[model samples]
Target: MNAPPYLSIVGWARNDGYTPNYAKRLEHSIGFLVRQLDRHRIPSEVIVVEWNPPPGSPLLADQMNGFLGGTSHASVRFIVVPPQFHRGPRGWQKRGMHVNNAANVGFRRARGRFVTPKALDTFYSDKLVSTIGRLDLDDRRVYRCDRLDARMEAESWLDLADDELLAALARHVVLRNGRLTHSIDWKMRDLHTNACGDFILMSTPRWHEIRGYQKDPTVLCLDSDSIALHAAAAHGASEVHWQEECIYKVVHGNTHAQRVATIWKDWQLKLDHYLILRHRRELAMNLRVWLNYPRRRVRGLEEILAPSIERHFVAKAARYAKNDTSLVTNDADWGLARESLSDRTVVRAAWDTP
Candidate 1:
């Protein structure tokens, strides 16, 4: 009998071209990942969640036939999340993608001992893959690594050998860990919370213990990943930052932050910045009294005063300054464990039965 997989890699995406050449990037990311795992002989499973797939577009799973060739060490599966679960409970209603909810769909179904939520366009370094392949990961620790942003045009190197691509892209390191390279006046260089959603690894059990990223769609698309890190720490999971291993993020034009930056003008940025400065002060006091604001009002404020403020201040404060010991955010039904969803085995390992 085949033993359970050593690790489960989970990521969520739609077929819509959200970023430039997104399909190509997704192909490289998953294909390279599968090849690397096979190179190291690691028994693993890759789960890609096709969350709220568009009406007239091809599903991501339909495009995986080309990615799974010559794959032996890892099995790949794709879960389809229907549109009903997209907006989430309490009528949150704002939707492009609910990262946490989509992730939960994969997390609840993962069959591996260890699980990590990754970005669709991310690539795992050889060093990182080798480390995980050893299966020496600790269930009591939450593993994190810094993200290196590469140039958008680096897609030309997609077919290059892994080491060649890695070496070629090393020069494009715009951000190392939390430090923004080639920046003269960016003061937000030291915060490790930057791009954290790209890679977060923890044991499957530990993920369940914390209930998989506060499924609150109300928070919108801001620092929920960082909050999950805090939740992990709160539940006594020690953080293990990988010093030598990091994930590579292919930078594109239409990311959430980049879009926000382009939309907000110089004056708007100044106004939002000032408002965030004040919001942080109020947040500190609110944390004391356990002050709570209506979700409607908060979302309205987010619309007016730059949602980036939630990422920078509100989440940072809740993660570091909060004194509560809440473990999981969703109810007992976290990850929609009870839902009957479509699960397709896109690529099975050679040892597995047809």
Candidate 2:
């Protein structure tokens, strides 16, 4: 039997107000993701759907159509969905939902056998590529990585200054394994919930079989991965945990307390409420103490120490930004580091389009 032709990697681009450096940061992040695919030698094409394009802005769909018309990825053809065909519910203002919808649009347009819905911010390992290779199409299993919070100490990188830059550098380093000796591990064996959309990989046929994301736009905090996993599970699809160190770098400058507070506020407003699902599945299973702890303790820490962490990150970013010749940028050392790490041969495959 012939191997699948391509891997449809679906992602989103935001039109929200961005800093001057936003495009560079986004490029690096997207580049990192693409590098992982390159590492696997996977012939893949990316679909970047836009949620809310600025008025008179070139249509994202047109951009995609142009890309598909021009670029070639072996058997894969990159394309973008026209905005006219893209529509979802309204009232929920969270970016996640918008991304989820955009991803679904990519999914519908994919002509490959396998469709991988990936977060633009996350990176992959050789292990992920190998794991996806073993999937049985008939079984339609959804694979999820045990997520490692890639939040590192800002001072680790010597080139960034300012809290934002430090936080960003710390995130980059952690995602790239700048610190920590061993990879963190997580398991969903006992959890009765779905996988995070950040890195969920599934077959294309199965994705369409489920009818894609709900059309109701009012659903906040709910996304394609949550809905897809649930649908797949209901269809008797099995779930497996790939416990390799897949890092998810959350680029937020808030503490756990702040995150909790944000979730609460968002939930109350009915804007984008879905933390309860996460709590029941991943957080409740692992960070039970933090979840069940008294509100007073959580609030106290948020008030007392969050400022310190923020300050440290700011200082670190500032310091690093001033020094471009930091040790972290030495490519020779990075090459050596890759060589010293355990040798795991990761093969990249083309996105499977049927």
Candidate 3:
């Protein structure tokens, strides 16, 4: 008998109004993913979904088409989610709606037995593909992995000291490990939850069984991971933390400080709204802890805290805030920094001034 076809990788690119580099970045990401998949000998396809077409944004679509044109992956396809309906709340745009819709469209068109929806901004290593390939798809299971450092180019403004950067990266490793080793496995209730949509692989049948994502057009500030997790759990799915290195670098468009401030502000608003809706006193309290306490304690806190707050609190507040527990409830590990001793690996600065 022929071996079963592997998972179908569905990627959605929602460029609200980005320039040509956005397309370049998307192409680069897709190329990297294709190469990784090829290395693993996994059958995969890339679906490029462009949403909310920007005025005079032909370059992005053209580039995407061009990238797909030369691909050898027989399953790859490109689609455009035409600007059809405005379902989101007034003044609040639904960025994920486009993604959900596009993925849904692709899901219908996909022939693979498994469907894994991944974010466009993520850059994956070969380990990611291998990890996904190794996951068990028979039972209802959710597999998750942690992210590596965000990739900041030499000219990017997010350049930080080697020690500081590694410290920040370590926090993610610690947090992910903490959640897996402690909370989720131990069944300890906590304020923080683990439901990141990125790097999560699930079977396609279960995906559609959950109705995919809610059609709430007004649901702004909500994350796709929380929705997926909740739906999966409600449908009798269990989550397992894959203790493998599936590293992906996040690319930031602003300075570390600016990124932190922006995240904090957004979390403040989201937590406030969550408090009113859920009426949970601990949520409000946890929001404060999430917003302030961790930042005050951790070194090189800017990089990890911003995204952590968004991932653990703001985006998926309902799931995390419902539980009043934390993975790291102490301050001892907060200030610890681990530095690499090897000088052979060159650590370049963010900017190379001529």
Candidate 4:
């Protein structure tokens, strides 16, 4: 009998207008993985789910051809999905443009015993492959990410060479032993201040038990990560492993990590700032899911009605977006920082184990 694949790494991305940059970073990310997996003869699989092309943007396949060609220890696959699957109210899709639904789609197709779901902006360290290979698999423990910090934001990732990017990260990224770092912002310019990455790793069985990631429309990027973390904790996971710095993240203008409100450069930019209200809804949605998950699981009464609740805030966000339009052109409000919520509350791990 054939041995099963050891690990599966899954991520999805779509860049309708900026496919080249996304494509380059993707190639770099995968190639980095291949370098480690191939030499060690690790049986691994990489699945990229590409979806939703803007009006004239080429299909993700056309933009990413030939990048997957390799005869090695790991197999690479590309999947094209319809955008309708990701569409949400107020034209909101998954938090990261593609979130739980996209990753879950890849999970359903994965063939490895161990699996990792990562953000598209994530770049794995060479040691990560071997780390996963050596991890003592515990059904109750899920692995979380360690980030190396550097706020090396580029207008286009293609602007810097791989070597240059590596040099920049080496100058920063904090790595420590037997310590867990939570939510380190890699986009920070201070090398020592920010050094970390966020990624999730676990056994396929544990993932299946948790029913994969929550696709609640209100869960934003941060909430999505939290939901998975809490789900693991709530499901009787003894503890989670936190690895040393081995993942690098890049902050591009378009990625979720870099989407704070800013001034419009000109009239065209003001008109194109259409995603303002849409993005703000992420704040509302995240709060709803975080607060309600426990109530729904514990009380079983009314089930934390989300649709009507989401509609209630949708109107508020719409008005906020309209208010933002005035600032887009005016100098006064253009630079005002966007505060997602005033009293940011914590979303804890609350899943009850049977």
Give the winner by lDDT: 1 or 4: 1
Stretches > 4 Å off in candidate 3: 1-4, 15-20, 59-61, 68-74, 86-89, 92-98, 107-109, 134-136, 155-195, 219-221, 254-354
lDDT of 4 at 283: 46
Give the poorly placed runs of model 4, Cα more than 4 Å off.
18-20, 93-96, 153-167, 172-197, 218-222, 255-354
Highest TM-score among the candidates is held by which one?
A: 1
lDDT by residue (tens digit), candidate 1, 210-315:
7887756453545567776767666667777788888987777655565443233555456546755876644433432242221222323246332344443344
Residue-by-residue lDDT tens digits, candidate 2, 1-354? 145445666766654433233334444445455555555555565555454554565543443332212222323233333333334444333322255455656667655567767665445544665555443434357666654445544423223332344246335553332222211222212222323666656677666656554343332323234445545555445766556635454444532324433213333323213444444444322332333222221232234211121121222223333332231211232111222111111222333324
Assess candidate 4 and give its lDDT: 0.50
Please, what are the lDDT tens digits per residue for candidate 3 over residues 304-325?
Answer: 3323433333434344334322
Question: Where does candidate 2 have its weakest 10-residue lDDT segment?
Answer: 336-345
TM-score of 3: 0.59
Error of 2 at 169 (Å): 9.0
Can you write out model 4's per-residue Cα lDDT over 1-354, one digit (the tens) per residue?
Answer: 145567777877776534346666766766665555666667776777675545567755566556545544676666666555556632253232545666766666666787777665566665665566674566666666566544554544445555565667666554332243432211111111122124667678766656666445443322344444444544555445454536776644454334322222354233334434565445434443333321211111122233322233222223322332221111221111121111110110111011
lDDT agreement with native, every candidate: 0.71, 0.43, 0.47, 0.50
lDDT of model 4, residue 141? 66
- Which candidate's lDDT is highest? 1
Ranking by TM-score: 1, 4, 3, 2
